[model samples]
Target chain A: MPGWLLWLTGYLVVRVRCAAPERFLNLALAQGLYFWDARWMGEEWLEIRIRAGDFRRLRPAARQARARVRIRRRVGLPFWWRALRRRPGLLWGVVSVVAAVYVWSCFVWSVEVAAPEGWQRLGPGDILAWAEENSLRPPVLRANLDANRLAEKLMLDRQELAWAGIRLAGTRVIIEVVERRFPDTATSTGPAHLVAERDAVVEEVTVIAGQARVKPGDTVRRGQILIAGIMLPEEGDQAQPGQGFSRPRLVSARGRVWGRVWYEAVGQAPLVEEERVPTGNQVREIKVIVAGREINVKPLRGIPYASFQEERWWWAWPVWRGFSLPLAVEAGTYREVEVRRHGRSLEQALDAARARVTAYLRVQIPAPAEILEEQVQVLPATPGQVRVRVTWQVRQNIATVFPLK
Target chain B: MAQGEKSSGGSKLRRVESSLVELLDLPADVVFDLPRLTVIGNRRVVVQNHRGIVAYTPRQVRVGATGGEVEITGEELQLEAILSEEVVVRGRIARINLRLT
Candidate 1:
């Protein structure tokens, strides 16, 4: 219907310049040559379109009419094929790119796992491995992915998850999950008392659902009850005149209490230190490993150092940004280092020992405790080793429930 | 007297054909060999059932028909197409005249 379709079918459009294009038209019509889109330019020149096969037949008629016929342009499949043959690389590149894009689009490329809030108790890798075993992994055909059914199946299979949803976004599969929140039944109905978990001087105590047994500035020991679960009728209440004496009520105590606590840790450092330092002498080699066979891509045969330590890293060969081949490259480097012993002053040894003690004490104290003060003392030790003990005083909230069995 | 009777018989034959055409409700153009001219807004003319183009030029085009010759005079007159049965004449048509041959 359009000229481009005619071009595909191999039609030729020629511009005929003649003294009498009208005679040519009449002659062509009488012979039934079937030409169309006849446009007349001034000064006996015109353009017309005809089938590619008809051009030879028109030549004979053109001789009789004495019209000058020249092919101004050549179009259609035959010409296109001729031009394509000249530059084979372009045609091959176009075909390869189209095929690569189509093949890549049909398979899954990436998988993303979203574990919200408290669901991170399990690592992402464990969930990803489970998904892979369940047939939800990269390189899976996109057409075979049933998102809704897979989500329902995953939720049913995992008892610890509250809900699971799988969404297909482009070539990436995104998995979202919510872990089930198990109820802590002890704090609600159990007969529990708020107790101090460490030796501390209580700075503040607020009892919400229990009788306050220890007040602010009160020195308390470990396992001492700060809030009582059992409420007894006091003498003051018994002295009041009432219609009847109410019995003692027991409750599950919940409260907040802040206390200052102390922690101590001991660490040691040597006066003379022996360390291995890199000597900047290294040999690097890159090799490609496919299956089990290895081929040296970048060989380094000269190893100047007799003794060295080697480090190796492997990476899969990248085909595109999001695509990779099965082949992997292993990079290994051998570095030569020298062992050196260095002497330090007594003050420097003491400072290093204190640093080590402080580092040890940090692990002993519970998190969320603000350090109020730290005191370090040099302990009696041998000549080579400098030993020190560190004491750290910190303020922390000490509110732990002790359920009475 | 024979020649006079023959001329009257020719007139009677023409009348009978006309009456038969009207009774049968046939198109007049089909019954009679006629050339149809379609003029579009003084810009183009399509001539159907034409014998051939007698003369063609940028100023005018003469098309031969059965009864007469159709003449088209205009500026930049182009013989767009010419089939065995039809010819498309395109230009700024200034005048159209049929000269009986």
Candidate 2:
């Protein structure tokens, strides 16, 4: 608004030389003109301000009053226009920059969706598909956008999402989401029996919400009930207690049943083998490409070494200030070129075979299993092969839910 | 009546008009057409409802007022602004004199 005053009024400083400059000032004031910041310049000269528009009107009065007016300085918008006219290139640059910013703001440049921690079900692809389907894709105009309404609509459609928010930051549309949590454990809903999943001897059984049918020393097979879903009725008739026609009530069952289990593995390793290792010598080849035109800068037509491990590497195109060209470069290298034969004694090979067998058995056991016993033995096998057999006894949870019929 | 008698009667009427202005709480400059001078800290002087300037110099300035000429003597005297009805002086003011002209 202050600039509006400067531009609309178009102020300038004038130096006036006259016998009575006050007479010229009073005449201007009488015509509803304004001036300020006047300074005396010795003799009959004085410096004062007047509007550029009123300068022409002042000339007549100045002539009549015998006052000489000379423009000392021009300011404000008119001055800026004259200055810009002298340098056309600078004026064009300024105008182009303003226009470019305007055009850039009209389109949505990027759609960014950040994933929440521990939320693997809702992926970036899923959010993008949903956003595109909902008309929130890139190249969208920011004007007439209702962010809150879009967020509410997204939340209403996505059952897994507990919260959804849309933010327009610069040229990017950012969607922040929070997913609903899935329960780690399920609750018993109806009457059911805790059945054994595998054949094993019961180690320890703890009843939490149902009747226990198996003791610590009892042996159970797969599909056998470990905890009962039915309990004895308190008011049962004594005569009908052992009858075949009596019906039993059912209830939801929950309990923990630990049992003893065993696993075995066999492995073999040869006494002699070959290993390829790095010889600390490598050849690198590079290529360059700009705007889809590729230049071949290969060091050689093919790998010269008799035996070499080749590795491929690629560099992507460069992008700056939202401008990119379809250009990329790929490079390759040949390394780890030496191969040697290594030999091991029978004891070392047997140790390696035993380690392999142990590792195989350890993978079969659960992380919470407690190993109660372990056994190993050397086996007779073909020539140049070390055969090993390993066995383990572990205590594990074997209880599984089974609804009563 | 003679011209001198008529001028005497005009003076008597002007005196009555000056008294009427005070009684009505009106500005004497508006009622009697007198120039108004305002000074601030001996550094600047503003004259409102002024007539014209008689003489101008660096150390002294003479501005025309109603029925008199006002003179200001100062160091580095500068006329700040000159409008039809107002004149402003800026500098270190030393002395001010009013002489009927």
lDDT of each: 0.80, 0.79
lDDT of 2 by residue, A184-223 (tens): 2344588888888778899899998777889999999988
Q: Going through the candidates in order, what is the number of backbone clashes in each?
A: 0, 9
Cα-lDDT of candidate 2: 0.79
- Residues A138-167 of candidate 1: C-alpha lDDT, one tens digit per residue: 899999998877888877666556788888
Regions of candidate 1 where Cα sits further than 4 Å from its true position: A1-5, A85-91, A110-137, A154-405, B1-21, B28-101
Q: Docking quality tier of candidate 2?
A: incorrect
Model 2 TM-score, all chains together: 0.42
